[model samples]
Target: MSFLPASADAEFDLLCIGNAIVDVLAPVDAGVPEAEGLVPGSMTLIDAQRADALYGRLEPEQQTGGGSAANTAVAASLLGARTAYLGTVAADALGLAYADDLRRAGIFYPTAPLDAERAGGHSTARCMILVTPDGQRTMSTYLGACTAFGPADLDERAVARSRMLYLEGYLFDPPAAQDAFRRAAEIAHDAGRKVALSLSDPFCVGRHRAAFRALAAGHVDILFANEDEILSLYEAADFGQAAAAAARDVELAVLTRGEKGSVVFCRGERTDIAAQPTTLRDSTGAGDAYAAGFLFGLARGLAIAECGRIGAVAASEVISHFGARPEGDLRALAGV
Candidate 1:
């Protein structure tokens, strides 16, 4: 695919849409997870009661805006992109906080909030991350009012004004969210903008492989996935087969392999990007941050090899910290 410079009149370099969540982080003893009947190093969906109960057990150390696409949006903004985000949040305290975080990150978050509490609907979504002594994170996510995201909730003007639209795979669980994303993708394409999709999880791919395949083949111009997710998408026997299959579906296929590195396939060419060296602190959000860097570079019309390098550098920064978003100066690190 040929690259185009973003029009000066464009309001946004990228527009990201997905679940809006508040992430609560805590450090706990190794035995704490087993005692609570929780699986370590796993992300499980929980109900409101389970969310409340598990939260009470955690002595949280930090709370920040986090979710697959939201994390990418924040990271992209930090990389000097004119970014915007669209995620449905309830008119609750956590929801308000999620908006505030995007503001601080220099990303515009359009608010057409639902009063979930008054309407007897769900509250804001939250992920409770429990870090063990081994530096492994156990996450319990409650996808609350973000499921209420539908076609009506989208910022149509923002979709048209942005140069690229990024969709998060996790939000595909809700039937309405699926419709909403499809609608957003159509608007973006109609306006001659690019559409990118991140296969958020391997399990998420397994759940909606058919829908994902259809969307990738039909609408998605840029595709992002880790090793396991691509395998799940095509049920391919190996990574090579999965990579080749993905290259056939999308205009640009970017696949990440932890520790080893990442590969990008575009215009019948492959580019290998070596992983940047860094201490393994926490692996959460590494892929999300990588996508942010890659997309930001693509938005700036940078070469594919340089984009991959920036992505690897961004992933390194996130993993060296405890959270999904970077805590260090990423622009300085990547030398943008």
Candidate 2:
């Protein structure tokens, strides 16, 4: 089997696959999500009409580039890792803007834009995130052109050259996208590179629990999930039970429990890292940023505890801000 730095040609530290989306964020009262028939802490898929309706009701405070995997890739790049993104967008204004933002952030996005003639009238994807007073973010996403992402988008050489392949569970909705996910995992594993996956949301876990469990058991080297998602994945009674179960399936299982902190399980060993203390703001991209920090440390060959600490520090910064993207230099904040 091929191994890392296999040819003295490995070009990147991380390759992330997921939907490419722009995020429009605004602070709202706790009741806004409920008033819009959305679960207070859940991410729900909506169409363009629904997205427009929600956007009209709220005053947008920030319109920035954001996607689960993209956010992680960006944060990782800022932390000094060579990161690349694989996803699709329409050949439209938002799509071009998204590409430009990623390039400016020092991320390599190599996916081809969808041809307008063949785009079926879809625009670039947009996610409307409503942050509540308690720092919880509720999302309504319009997938748009992202649904067109398929296995054909994978760049074989790019996958083979990455140290780790990071996947966002949100892209598994489309059958073709699932095929692409499996193909990417195969490429990474075939090259003896590790694969990391994030269970994007609890409801997302509910939608494909069986498939995700199988992927974690057979393909994933590192698994990231929040308390609710891990519990949902295993159908266990609590965190302990779920974590125990998760440890048996993946080489490393990382579980985040909001204020209680996070736990990492590997080879019968469990380490708990305290959440970094910070003034809470919005929790929109905390998990993604945490993954970025953890992966960054892993790429640098840091100890597991140090990796978790870096992740905690990265997460703390995102939660202390309003939008999903970081406002300052995360590398400076991480002291990497």
Candidate 3:
């Protein structure tokens, strides 16, 4: 069997690096959390024992492949951009499923699975997503083998082959992963390719604020973040302050606000792009989808404003679905 399908023969337009996780989603009433004594809107990492305990308490409605950066890579590929993903998983059922899902979505999958001891004894990285009637999703994650991912996991050749390298802020949680991120950044820079990063979540920003600032100032050429994440990163009192601070640090800063739309800042020029109108469904992958569309636009040489528009449309489509992965051809949805 081919490692990469025939469709991946050419040099990729983008390469993504981060944890590889599978998402378990279930629909429940908004009040279920209060009744079950579970926290809503916060992702907590649990050990294998805890994961089993939680798994036993509920019914799993669906299983799908996910990870912040991996989701963006898959979405970008579906938008007709050549993409590759780098991450680690155990040599277990979930690992195979994750790889297959990326491959089927037209993304180049290059990471190998861990040994049996890692897969069975320790849980695979799994996110238990609880969706409410109001289209809100609360997530509980078990990092498991994902935390074991480190610098050695990176594929330097693949990094050099891509036009851009994209990373997620969540990777900073594991100290070992920092080396891999730095290595990928160096490789991408040495090869004259752009490097992009998504501030995965507000908690992630709070966890690695200093390091993130250093990265934003030096390594990251393109930066993506939502209002809350940006505020946390800069320790700013409001969104505007954070956006201005980010613009001064990076070559391009794309800041997204849920209902207000998104802002693109580049070369001292700031432009606001209106959000595409859509009935809200689940906001699970809105940020990732927005990053996908924006990256896709950049890869296709579209203007910054047009890129933000594409990002908004992509986000709108994902919010109208239950899963983090896009349900249809996003290129068609973006009218590209």
RMSD of each: 1.7, 2.0, 4.6
Give the winner by TM-score: 2 or 3: 2
Task: Report the backbone clash tally of model 3.
Answer: 0
Query: Residue 234 of candidate 3: its Cα lDDT?
Result: 97
lDDT for each candidate structure: 0.89, 0.90, 0.84
Predict model 2's lDDT versus the native: 0.90
TM-score of each: 0.95, 0.97, 0.93
lDDT of 3 by residue, 1-336 (tens): 211113333388889988788988888887876665566765666667767777777687778888889889988988998899988888878888888988888888888888866444565688888889898877778887787778788888889888889998877787778877888899888877888999888888888999999988989988999998999999999888999999999888999999999998985689999999999988888999999999888887788888889899889999897888888778788899
Rank ordering of all candidates by TM-score, starting from the highest: 2, 1, 3
Using TM-score as the measure, which candidate wins? 2
Q: List model 2 lDDT by residue over 74-141, tens digit each.
A: 98998999999998999998999999999999998888789975456889999999999999899999
Q: Which residue runs does candidate 3 get wrong by more than 4 Å?
A: 1-10, 34-39, 116-121
Residue 180, candidate 2: Cα error in Å is 0.5
Residue 153, candidate 2: C-alpha displacement in angstroms: 0.6
- Which candidate has the top score in lDDT? 2
Candidate 2 ranges with C-alpha deviation above 4 Å: 1-8
Model 3 lDDT, residue 255, Cα: 93
